[model samples]
Target: MFVKVVVVFLVMVGAALAFPHAPVQQPYYEQQPLMPYEFGFGVQDKYSGQNFGQRERSDGRAVVGSYSVDLPDGRRQTVNYKADKYQGFVADVSYTGQAHHPYH
Candidate 1:
């Protein structure tokens, strides 16, 4: 019994020394810089009846934008939106003009 216990102890010690513990490593992350910008674009084709416009600006902390499109029903749909770290995202939708339907 004594010899068996000694042999088990020696085997455990040998295994521990044979495979040493590896040093732990922490994860690494790269940070990117943010820049402020503003841009607006629009398109209008009277012959094809396609009209749309969008304007947006970002100040690094918050973003605000509005887009308007001429819907097929003759009404124009406008959507105004804003987003930020504090407020999250919010949008207001509105429409203008009346819809007309032609019967065959």
Candidate 2:
């Protein structure tokens, strides 16, 4: 009970310190991660939106694979799907302006 309370307090404190300059703008959209094996595919964050999902079961001792998000504008962002989230192999994400249609 005491540990839980302390943990919660610390989390709140950390969040406050971390996002001290967070945009006051309210998020216009929200998305949840996909379940294992179930994939959610769509033009991720295209035109004006956010796209986020997880390739099911691409973790653990399993031979990791690669994944990509091709926006509506001919831009393919590939990322290695590795064991564990965040701590796994990942290329620092980069941004690119749409040059062509992703529908291609």
The number of the candidate with the highest TM-score is: 1
Number of clashing pairs, model 2? 5
Each prediction's Cα lDDT score? 0.89, 0.56
Instruction: Kindly give the stretch of ten consecutive residues in candidate 2 with the minimal lDDT sum.
Output: 54-63
RMSD per prediction, one decimal?
A: 6.4, 17.3
TM-score of 1: 0.66
Question: Which pairs in model 1 have colliding backbones?
Answer: none
Q: State the lDDT at 2 in candidate 2.
A: 100
Candidate 1's C-alpha runs over 4 A off are 1-30, 102-104
Clashes within 3 Å, all models in order? 0, 5
Give TM per candidate.
0.66, 0.26
lDDT of 1: 0.89
**What would the per-residue lDDT of candidate 2 be over residues 1-104, giving only the tens digit for each residue?**
99999999999999989886756874453234434453445445566666644343532333344456646565656665555444766444543556675556
